[model samples]
Structure formats: structure tokens, C-alpha cells
Target: MNDTPGWASPGSAPSDGQDATVPRPSEPADSGGASSKWSAAQPPAGQWSPPSGPDGTPAPAPGPAAGWGGPSHTGGPGHNGPHHGWGAPPAAKPGVIPLRPLGIGEILDGAVSTLRAHWRAVLSVTLVVAVVSQIGDILVQRYLLPAPVEVDPNASPSEALDQAADSAKASLVALAPSLAITLIGTLFTTAILTVVISRSVLGRPVTLSDAWREARPRLPQLLGLTLLLPLISVAITMVGIGPGLLIGSAGGVALTFLGGTAAVVVAIWLMIRFSLASPALMLERQGVIASMRRSAKLVHNAWWRVFGVQAITLLLTFLVSLVIGIPFGIIAMAVDGDGLGGLLSGSSPEFGWPYLIISGIGAVIASAITYPISAGVTALLYVDQRIRREALDLELARAAGVPGYGSDRPGHGPTGG
Candidate 1:
């Protein structure tokens, strides 16, 4: 999917914050084909034993122990098979994910489950963001947008084409402020919701205040990161089109189209690769550049998986928005008649505040529901990547206060549930 090593992230530093005597394991527990993808590495009951010390004394219970299948992380004591196949203890549901690798459905379900469990916090963040974004869009549409140059129904073809071009130009210009608002609001909400989702994964209650306090300081960098991606994308796209413009021939035009398409493909790839940046930055407290680097790294081995989950999430949100917006759009059209058509077409036809307000209301409703889903999926994806790479599942388990796990270990905080 990538020409270079851009998709690869630096492996997390393997550390020992668990019991001193029982060494931390580097590899993960191996669950063979029998178990489900996201199933936990369930040793038989009482198999989680502490390792023996150098002098043969039993070590204390380990905290952030090794991943599944690691040498140090063999069954602790009174143990049988290291990886239980049949009748393995059921995966603990203390948090969103089992204490193991995550399946795609698990990630998506975790996002929705968090929303269901903590609707108050998720909806609160999204409500504010949606209002802000809808208001901006409405203002742009009503005030800043250029009046549509009404195309003469009987005009010559060239004249109508010119009018169409102008209308498109006006529409694009009008959409700028709305686009900016959406991006900024998404960054803000993503930050806060990442914290919410992180806490939710531990089955801990997270307040809006807690999310904001943890996320607020990273707002500026998040803003930078959000803006940078689009700007870089646009620049890359222009590079694709520039040569065609320079040549200004039919062949040049064809080249430009091909370049633009190629550019779009690359841009989407980059976006998916960096999709986990917000979660990484907000949770890891990293700077924008470092977070992006980390995201690219985490996305390395899992590009297709990430892309699939993101595409599914994107499809879901789009469907929800469309479902919510359609009835309101029809209502607006009925209420405002041809004026609604004229407004959309960039032509003036007694523009009414009622039409804009109704449409904006629909948008707000849709946005409020969709924002949390988008943010939650991205955050969970980041967590999933860390679990795969750094054995973050153990850390998360400890944070969630799962028994048999060490408490207050490094990289696991903000909850003791």
C-alpha cells in the first residue's frame, strides 16, 4: 500500500513495571484457530502464576507482564496449557476489549457501547460541536455565499456553461467557512472524545470535565495537525495538476486528470495512515509531529485493517446523516418551494431564514449523532494498534483495575475501576 516504510511505527519500548522477579514477556500469548479473533488468552483457572525467583522463591504477582506466547508469560502456577483452547475461562469484559487483540467488530462495538453507556458525556461534547458547526454553515450559506447567477433558460450553450462555472465557483467559496468549521470542531471533539473513549474502555465513568481537562491542553496541536493534513493533501493534489496546467494541451489535460486521481489515492492512503494521530496525541500527550509519526508507525502492518474499519465507520456515519437529513430536506423544500431550489442552485429566490434554520437543525441532529461514532472508532483503533505492538492490553487491564494485574503501572492511568 505504501512505497516506503511510512506505514511502520516504532515498536513500543518493552519495559518491566510488573513484578521484579518474574521477567516481562516480549511476545503475546498464542491463541490458536479455535478461539475468536479478539478472544482473551485464557489459561485454565488458577494458571496465572507468578514466576519463580532466582533463589527459587515465588515472585510477586506481575503488573505489565509480557504479551501472549512470550517465554516469561507461561502459565503462572497450578497451570496447565499456556493458551487454553477448549473451556478456557471466558474473556473478561471489564472494559471495552477483551484483554487481548481486538477484532474489527469488537472495535466498532466498543465505540457504540461507550456511547450507550455514557451517552451524557458523548452527547454533550457532540452537541456543542454540532451547534458550532451548523451555525457556521448556516452563516456561510446565508451571508457569505455569492448570489447565484441565474442561467437564462433560453441562453446559448456557452452562456449557460459560463453561468454554471460561476455558480460552481460561488458554491466552492461559500463552502469554505463551513468546511473550516467542521474540521476545527472535529479536532476539538475528537480530543475530548478520545479521552472519553479511553476511560470508557476501562469501564470507568468519565465526566465532560475530566475529558476536557485532559484534552484542552492539546487543542492547539490538534488544530495544527488537522489543518496540516488537508493543506498537505491539497498541495500534493496541485502537484499532480500543475503539469497539466503548464502544458495546457488536451494531452496535458488528460495528464492532469490522471495526476489528480493518483493524488487523491495517495491522499486517502495518508489520511488513513494518520487517522490514529488524534488519539495518539491526546492520550500519549505527544506533539503534533510526533503524534503523526507515531500514527504512521502504528498503522504500518495494519493498513488494510485500519482502512476497512475506517471505511465501515465512514459508511455508517454517512448513512446516519443521510437518513436524518432527508426528511428535513423534503420538509424544507415543501415549505420554501422553488426558493429552496434557487438557493441550492446559487440563484436568489426570496431566500428565507426558515429554510436555512430547518436544514441547519437537521444537520445538527445528524452531526450530534455521527461525531461520537467517528471519534470513538479512531480512538479505539489507536488502542488496538498499541495492544498489538506494545502489549498495551495489559496496561489497560491494570488501569481498569482488573484483579491479578499490577496497579498504577506506567502507561496505565486515569482509572482504577
Candidate 2:
């Protein structure tokens, strides 16, 4: 790995901290039905030996190694056959997560573990971003956004329809500024947190300064990726609903509904496919397009799995936000002197500074807690996918200074006589 916390593309040369003498093996070709896809220099089953020394002898065990797959792992000692004893050894866990394919629960736990273990750095990064985002939101709400559109229940049908249209437009207008602020905030937070989580995986310590220094160079590419995804989704949506919208008739409305649903399905599939792009960009030093392509490749065989984990994360975060926000929301209403009457009557309350400030606090707290989990899952998912597909745990072990994995640093490795 690089000092800045990155890995080389799969099947490529080792990165900065990896030993150059230990070359990575090329991956098998995908689904070509030709035996040539398999490497010709094959060891017989259960006869694979670990890397040998200069004398062509199997290197001695590197003194009491730990973790799954033994100390010198190339898919563990059991790679070629089933375990014959008390089962496989536990995977090496130098950091927040085990250095192997991760379970969903493990992925979620790993994110939370990083936050707990490095609360200061994680919270510092998140709190700052959330506070700034909320401040912009409060300012926008207070002075810039238009008041909610008032529709009279007694208005004629045509008048009511007009009011509804006006309301929709107003809602979009109000949402625009806040969403923009959120996008910018997420960009910064994701970049920084990725570095933090990556370090944590190696069981290494990191500070906010370290994370920022590592992440700063990649911010532009991250931003471009962030902006591009939404635009792509929007373009897909417009393409789906455009014709129906143009017709402006009841039939057109039905067509729009059908088209929009299909478009949403496609958009969602694409989003899940590209979900790992941000981390790929941040960690691989990849460009915007390259990172996206990398993500698509990683997600290729695991679309539903990725979608399921992401959905669970989304649901959990939403629940957490609601739990944290509701009390603050109620208090804000009480403090703002609006009471619950508006809520009971299905009407919007006019919020004052007290309400905005109090609610903003809730938003900040919720965001501070949720950001790490969200970003961590994405980064770890990227790691997990690579581990599954490319046998990246070996590289991670080397980078983490695990014995018997072979180290690049002089004093870190066992010296051969």
C-alpha cells in the first residue's frame, strides 16, 4: 500500500509499501470456456508450497504467526482442499475488519467499530461537515426559500390544480439549495472518512490532519464523480418521462408513470453498480471515469448483494435520523411557540430561529453519527469485493506488517540467514 492508503489495480504490481520481489499472479479470464484461461504452471492439489528463499528452500515459518489462512497465506493452507481438523483458523484482523471476504453484519460492525475506535477523528470530520451543511440550510430556509404555497380548500377544481402545481414547483425550488449544500458536504466527508477507514482496516492510527492530507489531493476527482452520478440519474429520468410529459393528457400521464418506473429501476441498477466508485477513486488514485468503471467491475457479480447491504444501511440511517430528530423536532415546535396544533391539523408551522437552530442541532448530530457508517461501508465494501475477487487480503496483510506475509520495511520482516 501507499503511504496515503491506496492499493494497485488488481493483478497489477504491488504499491509503495509492498515487497517488489513478490509479484502478484494474474487473474483468470472471465467465462471464455477455454482451458488457456488457467495458468499452465500449476501445482498439484494440496501440494502448494509457500514462497521459497534464495536457496530454493521453503522459507522457515515466521515465528508464531496468527490469523486465518496461516501466516503465509495464498488463500490459506486449505486453499486446495477442505479443512481436516478443527476448521480453518480465524482470519487475520489487523484493523477494524478481518482481512478477507466480509459478511454483511461484519461490514456494518466494521464501520461502527472504526467510529468507536477512532471517535475523535471520525466525529471531528463529520461534525464539521454537518455543522457547515446545516448552517447553510438554516440560512437558506430563513431568508432565501419562499414560504409554503397556501392552497384554499374552498378553491374551485381548476384553482386547486393550479395551486398544487405551484406547490410542487416551490418545493423543488426550496430543495435545490439545501441539496447542493449536502452534495458538497458529502463530497468532503466521504473523501476524508475513506482515508480514516482505510487506515483503521490496517489497525493503524490516524488523525484528522493525516486523513485530510491524504484525501485533499483526490477531492476534485471525488467531486466530479459525485456530481456526475446525479446528473446521469436525472438524465435517465427525463428520458423516461419526457414523452408522456410532452403529450400532457391522461394517457400521457399513464405512459409517464410506466416509463418513470422502468427508468427508476434502470437508474437504481446503475447506481448500485457504481456505488463503490467514490472509494475506488479516493483509494486507487483513479480518475472519475476509471473509478466508475472499477466500481462496475467489482459490482458485476454481486449487484443484489451490494444493493441489499446499501438498502439496509439506508434504512438504518433513516431510522436513526428519525429517532434523533423527532424529539428535537417536537421541542423545536414547543420552543418556537407553534405547539402541536399545526401537526394535528395537517398544516405546516411557521418556524423561527429557535426551531431552526434546535432542529439544525438534531440534523448535525444525526449526520455526525451516520456519515461514518455510510462511508465506512462503502470503503469496506470496496475492500471486501476486492478481497473476494482479487485475493487482496494478502496485500493488506503485507501492508499491515503481518509476519510471514512478507514485509517491505527493513526491520518489519524476519531476516534470512
lDDT of 2: 0.81
Superposed model 2: Cα runs more than 4 Å off:
10-87, 152-164, 339-341, 344-346, 407-417
- Candidates' TM-scores? 0.76, 0.81
Model 1 per-residue lDDT tens digits across residues 1-417: 011111112333322122333324345444454545664766789777678999999987755434432212322221222333343444445766665567778888888898898899889989998998888888877778776666678977556655755775677787778779989888878988888887777677778887888788888988999999889898988898788757766577678789989999999999988988888777766788988888887787678989999999999999999999999977877798777778778765665777788878999999988898888888888877666655555555555556655545333243211
Please give the CA lDDT of all the candidate structures.
0.72, 0.81
On the 0 to 100 scale, the lDDT of residue 192 in model 2 is 93
Global local distance difference test of model 1: 0.72
Q: Report the number of clashing residue pairs per model.
A: 13, 2
Top candidate when judged by lDDT against the true structure: 2
Candidate 2, poorest ten consecutive residues by summed lDDT: 76-85
